[model samples]
Target chain A: MRRAFTEELQFISDQLVEMTRLTSTALDRATTALLTADLELAEAVISADDTIDLVRRDLDSRAVDVLARQQPVATDLRQLVMAMRMSSDLERMGDLARHVAKLTRLRYPHKVLRGPLEPMFTRMAEVAEDLVAEAGRIIANNDVEAVPQLLVTDDEMDELHREVFRTLLADDWGHGVEAAIDATLLSRYYERFGDHAVSIAQRVVYLVTGEWPEEDLHIEERMDVSRVEPLG
Target chain B: MRRAFTEELQFISDQLVEMTRLTSTALDRATTALLTADLELAEAVISADDTIDLVRRDLDSRAVDVLARQQPVATDLRQLVMAMRMSSDLERMGDLARHVAKLTRLRYPHKVLRGPLEPMFTRMAEVAEDLVAEAGRIIANNDVEAVPQLLVTDDEMDELHREVFRTLLADDWGHGVEAAIDATLLSRYYERFGDHAVSIAQRVVYLVTGEWPEEDLHIEERMDVSRVEPLG
Candidate 1:
């Protein structure tokens, strides 16, 4: 019975890693689609989101089943509960990717990120990729050390988010109000993607080390959006 | 043992209802702060968010404790799990309200919503209040009937979201790019608040009636963001 419980836990862990992989691929393709206005690629990303959602639902149900069968206590019970949460964070990451794809489709034949916005978003995508990949590794191997590096990557994503605002608010910005609105929403989608990845990594580290990262505990509050004040 | 489990479930349900109340107050006050540029009101909303987070943590720990002590199976296990999910949704609604307050504080003494944006946001806040209040009632009473009404309110929020874009993209938009960026982010925040409320209400209806709402299953995907297309 003990051996079977361990196997179930391992299966759930593997599915979570798979979710990270799917979201990473989705976000990468969505970025490419947005950059080039590739309608076909965007459509694919939008449609593939269902697979991620299904995986999450399957993983969550299995976790509950294990709880019902095994009646895990203490550390074991907490682990199952946290697995459900990690799956939620990953599912949301996939949703953010789909949001990007939908926006791309909404603006078909017209590239959404051009001029200064292009390079900042490109860098944001890179940071988001690194964060999700590291989150996957941490979950798979229980590598707590990778968390600090992941937090740094999240910082980069936040900086890029602020930079997007700066570019939009610049005096010579010629993209007009419409483009600014698009940039604002698109930048938020990418930044939120990174936030969800950081959340997953933090959960894994907590499960392994039993200690929440001190400085990054209230990460949702540390968004540094204060710097995003609009120019009068 | 069964009697104790029932009592514990009642406690968890009460806490969930309390969460809805806190978030409703937070959003309502945050909207006022944004429109009035009242720094103190915004500060109050921001600081009070920690209370909501604490309540969620307390509720979650208790839920886990009940799961361990009772070793409930089948529907009982599912109820505990779904309670955790509902608490998460409510906690996130609080975070969204905090986001609005933070934005308000960041732009102290400067109103974020003006002109046509004012009336629209006023209505969005009103809808948000209704959705959350109804979510509380549904959880408290298992009132499946309220779900349809809550969904209609969600649709109104979506329409308001589209109107926000139309106002920004109009040829005669007088606000600069900075204000437009702020408006875009703020509008998305209110819309997402509505989405989380709809998700909570749907979860309650599913738990009570054993049937998911057919039309609103994927509330996230039906965000109608496609209608937010930027004008050339």
Candidate 2:
């Protein structure tokens, strides 16, 4: 019974790792669709979400079954529980991916965004994909060292995201209003995906080290976000 | 030993309930800030995040301690694992609330989003907050019946989100590109937060019932999404 239970957990963990990898790839493809204005690839990403949803359902069910039948305790239980939560996060990340894909679909042919916005998308895509891969590796190797990698990637993503906001908010960025709006919405999607990826990485670090990395997280979440000064 | 373990598990469960409540309240404030453009409330919400983060770290440490020390098997183990997992989800949901709050600080002034757009925000807020609360109640009471509440709330959020999208994307809508972009990003944040809440409710339901909602989440997920046909 003990051996079977361990095997079941490992099986679930492996599946989680696999599903996470696929989720990352989905985001990567969706980004490509957006940048290259490929409606077909975007549609494929949208349809492919069904598969992620299925994997998510499977993972959730399997985690529950393992909990019921095998009855996990302490460390093993934590791993199983973490896997289930990460499954939901990864699945939602896939949805955001589809949202980007939807953007590609909506604005195809005419290229609604400004040419300068391309690097922002490129940087967003790079960081998003790297974080996904990082999360997958975290689960697979159960590595403690991967936390920094994820943090650094989030930094890179946030910097690119700020640039996106600054350009749009600028007076003379000159994409005009409509294209600027497209750029803004797309930036929000990218930034949030980066946040989810950070959450996953945090979970992975905890799984391995049982440490919360509290100090580090505080720094990452820190922003110039301040009270809106009274209008002069 | 078993009784002590159960008590500790119950304590963690209580924390989860409390954390969920805190998140819901914060979300309420965040949405209010979004609607009223209350920079003070938005600032307060942003600052309050530290408390949420602290609670999250505490929960993680406790769960990990219970797991590594007790090595539980079965339902007892499941509860511990789920507690940890739920805490993380709640934590991230808090972050999403924080995101909404920060968006309010961006000077979009909720007053401008009047008429149906206004009601749409109100409706989205109601559903989002209720879903968070329902998920909490489900876990707190272990009420399987409450699972359907989340489903209904999710459906409502989706519908409202679609309405927002249609208005923003319509050529006759008359708003410039900036407003449209803002609407899309804001609605997405609301929609995705609702999705997380539903997923949490589903987990709570599955925790007790050993199954996810059988009525088809895939259809539900795609239903509210704006189906703007790709520009050929």
Candidate 3:
């Protein structure tokens, strides 16, 4: 029974890594479709998102099954629950990729991105893909050391996101209101995709170290302070 | 043991209701702060989000404890897992409200939603508050019957979200690019808040009926179709 439980835990980990791979590929394809205005590729990405969702559901059920059957305590329980959370974040990342693809479909041959913004979107896509691929490696290998590099990639994505905004808000901005909106939404999708990847990496760090991530330290401090405050 | 387990389940339910209430209040205050540029209210909302996060952590730990101790199966297991999911959705809803409040802080005395956009945001806030309040009621009473009404409210929010975009993209739009970006992000906060509420309600319906929500029907259909497709 113990060996079976161990195998089940390993299976859940493998499922998460697979989900991450699919999500990474989806984002890459979605980005390509967006930049090149390839409707077929966009459709393929859109259609592929369902697979991510299905896998997430399967992973969640398996996690719950392990919980019910093994009744894992302490570290084991945390690992199982964290797997569910990571799957959720990965599924959301897939949804963000689909949103980018849908934008490509919506604009079709018109090309939603143009001018100086084109290169920014391209870079954003690259950073996002790199981040997810790293996220996959971290999950598969339990590599806590790789986590900081993921944060750096996420920072790059943020910089690109802000750059996109600056270009839209610049005085020399020539993109019409429609294009501006498209660019704004597209930038947001890539930015949020990076965020989910970082979040998954953070969960992995927590799983390995059994400590809260530093970014959450402030919130934990505030939570402590709030608890001591006199009741209103 | 059975009685204690039942009591623990009730405690988890109560925590969810409390989380929903806090989330609803946060959105209300955040919306008010956004419209009035109330720095104090915005600060309050931001600080309050930490409390939500702490409560979520506590709820999650408690849920895991129940699973490990009781080894609940079938309906009991579903309820525990669903509670965790709902708490997560509510916690995310709080974060979205915090994002709205942060926007208020970023702009300081300057209002984010000005002119015609003001009323639209006001309406969006109302719908979000209503949906969350209904979510609280559903959790507190186990009132799955109220689920459909929550969807209707979510639809209302979607309409408002679309309207905000339409105004931003309209030929007559006078809002500069910065304001447009602000409006786009703000509308998304409210829209996502509504989406979380709908998701919580769907969980409630599923908990009661043992059937998936209608909205998921299409995704399941797509998953079926994807399974038969030739591998690329």
Candidate 4:
């Protein structure tokens, strides 16, 4: 019975890693769709999100089953609880990616990202991808050491997000209000994707170290320096 | 012992309802701060969020303790798990309110909601507040009958969210990119606030009926028709 419980716990952990992999692919595909105006790719990302949601529901239901049957205590119980939270975060990451894809579809055939901003957004996507992938590694191996590096990746994402605002606020910004709104929402979606990754990493840290690092849960709150100062 | 478990479950339910009240107040004050440029109110909303966080931690810890001691199964087990999920939704509701408050502080002394958009935002805030308060009532009374009305309120929120984009994309929009970005973020924030409320209400419906709603988990994804079309 005990060995069976151990295997169940491991299965739950593997499902979390799988979720990260799915969300990472969704984000990458969504970014490509945005930059290339590929409506088909965007639609694929949107439809693929249902799979992530199914995984989350399955994971949570399984966790609840483990709790009901095995009745784990202390560390084991906390791990199960934390697993459910990580799934929630990963599922949200998928939804954010779908939001990006939907935006692409909404502006079909017309490239939402243009010229110089394209590279910056590409970098943002890469960093966000790196963060979720690192989070997956941390979960699979319980590698506490990888968390600090994952956080550093999130900082890069925050910087890129701020750069987006600076561009929109610049006097030379010729993109007009519609493009600016698109950029604003797109930047927020990517930044939020990173935030969910950090949240997952933090949960792993807490599960292993039994201590929540003194940092905020969502780093976007502290780094929300992207606020718009009212123009004169 | 069974009586003790029942009491513990009730305590967790009351805590969820309390969190809804706190978040409702936070959203209300944040909107006032944005519309009136009240730095003090914004700062108050920001600081008070810590209390909501603390309540969630205490509630979850207690729920975990109950699960360990009672080893509840079946219906009792499901209620405990659902309580934890509801607390999470309420906690995120607080964070969204804080985001609104922080934006107010970031643009301090500079009103974020101006002129024509002011009334619409005020109405958004009211609808959000009503949704949360109704969620609290549903939790307290197991009020499945109230769920339909709560969803109708969310539809009103979606309408307001769409109106925001319409205003920003209007040809007569004199507000520059900065203001448009501000409006876009603010509208998304309030819309999300309503989404969380709907999430909590859905949880209640599922807990009572043991059936997931046929509608999407987050109405925002379905109602996200506020997409920006590119200009010529």
Candidate 5:
């Protein structure tokens, strides 16, 4: 019975890892589509989100059922709950990626407006990539040590986002009305993606330490965004 | 036992309503502070976030515990899960409000540049104010019917956000540098606040429908954001 229960717990972990992988891929594809204006890629991301959403619901229902059936005790219980909550976060990430893809497929040509936003998007993609990988790694190994660093990645994502806003607001490069809105919304999606990553990391800490961190410290992003100004 | 459980749930519901009410006030306070450059008000909002965060965390943990202990079946289970998720949304709402407070507190002394953004922010505040109240009302009564209309409010928020970007990209309304970055970030924060509100409504749908909406209109919001650029 214990072995069967452990396998069930492992299955939940596997599902979380799958969602994290898909979310990261979606982010990557969305950025690629946005940078290259690949409508096909954008459409693909949009359609793919349906699958991710379906998996999320299926996994959540599965987690709840496991709770009902197994009555997960101690660490097992925490892991199951973590899976449930993280599914929402992962699903949101998929949604953010789809938004990026929509930007790629948007009727307005983003290439018309030249700005540093592409670089910012690239950096955001890298950070998101690392975050999803770390999330999967943590779940795979149940690593507590990595959770602290995920917070740092989230901070970095915020800084890049702030830079994107500063660039758009720059007198030399206003990113136009179309570009400005795209940049604004795009930056927000990435920032939120980071927040969910932070949420995943926080859950890891709780699971491992069995003590919720006293300080969220996740919100203490470095640098005052107000200090940021036009790069040019 | 059932009566006692109902009473406990009632107290929890009261706390949720009270939290939503105070946080909406906090949102207004933060926005007002941002618009008026009221450092005192901004500071108050920032400090108040602590209390809101505490309540949010306590409620979330308690909800999970209650669900685990009581093993609420059917409607009871759904309600408990919904509370857990909504409290998380409320916590994020608090964060967004505090973010606006940071903007207000940080951007002090730099007078807001009069541009198209001011109107956008005004509209956004109006929409956000109404939606925030609506979320509380829906939660208080568990009214699923009200969610569809609230979903439209999220769409309007997107429209205003797009308008702000269009203005930023506008060639005529260039406001130089200092006030522009502040304005851009300010609008972005408002947009994000709206996103959190939409997330809350989505959870309400999930609570009622027992699944994520077939059409995730909110996720694609930023995807279509670049489409509203003013024609030359």
Candidate 6:
């Protein structure tokens, strides 16, 4: 029974890594669709999101089953809870990727990436993909050391997100309101994709260290700095 | 021991209801701060978010304890798991409200909403507050019947969110790109607030029915229709 429980736990971990890989692939294909106006690829990413969701639901039920049957306490219990949280973060990352695909489909034959913003979206997508790939590695290997690197990647995504906004809000921005809205929403989707990756990494950190990432940073400081200004 | 476990479950439920109430208050004050540009109220909402976080952490630990000690299975296990999910949704709702407050503070002394968008924001806030309040009642009373009403409120919020976008994209839109970006982010915050409330209510629905809301509606149809276009 103990060995079976151990195998169940291993299965859950493997499932999370698989989910992360799917999310990364979805983001990659979605970005490709966004850049190249590939309707087929966009549709593929949109449809593939259901697979990620199904994986999350399966992992969740498995985790719950382990909790019920194993009656795990302490570290074991934490791992089960963290698995649920990681699955949620990864699932949300998948949803964000789907959002990107939907945007690609919405614009269709017309590319959503207009002038000046194209490179930023490209960089955002690259960062998002790297972040999810790293997230998968962390989950698969239980590598706490790789967690900080994910934060740095997220920072890069954040910088790119800001650059997208700067171009949109620039005095010379000629993309008009529709394009601006598209850019705004698309940048946000990519940014949030990075954010969910970071969140999953944080969960791994907590799982390993039993300390929340928020404890290392002031709560106020942890709030999306890009979204708010320093209080007077 | 069974009695103790039952009380622990009740306590966790109470904590969730309390968290819901706090989130509703946060949204209310955040909306007030946004509408009035009341820096003090904005700061109050910002600072109050920490209390909600602390409550969530406490509730999480307690739920973990219940799971570990009681080793609850079947329906009881489901209820505890659902409580944790609800607490998380409430905490996120608080964070969304804080996002609203942060935007208010970011644009302090100058209002974020201007022109025709003003009344729309006001209505969105009211809808958000009402949805969260209903979520709290659902948690406290275990009122699954009220879940559908929350969805109606969410629909109202979705309409307001679309209206905000329409005004932003209108040819007559006098608001500059900066204001448009702010409006975009702000509307999203409120929409997400509604989403989280609906999520909590769905958890309640699941707890009562042992059936996910998705099973009631087509999963693809349930995916945020406002964000995506129908696949051709």
Each model's DockQ score: 0.66, 0.29, 0.34, 0.54, 0.35, 0.48
* Best candidate (score: DockQ): 1
Weakest ten-residue segment in model 5 chain B by summed lDDT: B223-232
Per-residue alpha-carbon lDDT of candidate 2 for residues B1-232, written as tens digits (9 for 90 to 100): 8888888888888898888888888889998887888989988998898788889878877876776667676666667666776776787778778877776776655443544577788888888888888888888888888677678778777778767866665667665554555566667667767776776676676578766567546633433343422222
lDDT of 6 by residue, A68-116 (tens): 8889988999999989988988888888888888878887889888888
Q: Which ten residues in a row have the lowest lDDT in candidate 6 chain B?
A: B223-232
lDDT of 4 by residue, A1-108 (tens): 889999999999999999999999999999999999999999999999999999999999999999988999999999999999999999989999998999898888
Residues B1-232 of candidate 1 have per-residue lDDT tens digits of 9999999999999999999999999999999999899999999998999999999989999999998899999888988998999999998899899989988987777888767899999999999999999999999998988888888888898888888889988877897777788888889888889988888888887788767678544667655467444342
Over 4 Å off, model 1:
A227-232, B227-232
The alpha-carbon lDDT assigned to residue B210 of candidate 2 equals 61
Deviation (Å) of A169 in candidate 1: 0.6
Model 6 error, position B131 (Å): 0.6
Which of the numbered candidates is closest to the native, going by highest TM-score?
1
Query: DockQ score for model 6, please?
Result: 0.48
Docking class of 1: medium
| TM-score of predicted chain A against the true chain A, for each candidate | 0.96, 0.90, 0.92, 0.95, 0.89, 0.93
* lDDT for B51 (candidate 5): 86
How do the predictions measure up, each by TM-score? 0.97, 0.77, 0.93, 0.96, 0.87, 0.95
Mind giving the per-residue lDDT tens digits that candidate 1 earns over A1-232?
Answer: 9999999999999999999999999999999999889999999998999899899989988999999999999889989999999999998999899998988988778888768888888788889999999999999999988888998888788778878887887778887887788888888888889888888888887788777777554768645356444343
Give the per-residue lDDT digits (tens) of candidate 2, residues A66-139: 76666566667778777877887788788888888887787777564685788878888888888888878887
lDDT of 4 by residue, B1-232 (tens): 9999989999999999999999999999999998998999999998899899999999999999998889999889989988999998888888888888888887777887654799999999999999999999999999999999999998888888888888889988897877788888888888888888888888888889898887755444643533323232
Off by over 4 Å in 3: A217-232, B217-232
Interface RMSD of candidate number 6: 4.0
Q: Name model 6 segments beyond 4 Å from true.
A: A214-232, B215-232
Interface RMSD of each: 2.4, 5.7, 10.4, 3.4, 4.5, 4.0
- Looking at model 5, residue B186 earns an lDDT score of 67
Per-residue lDDT for A1-232 in model 3, tens only? 8899889999999999999899889989998998899999999998899899999999999988888778788889889989999998998888888888877887787687978998998888889889888998999888999988888887787777767777887778987777777787778778878888888888999999998788854432221211211211
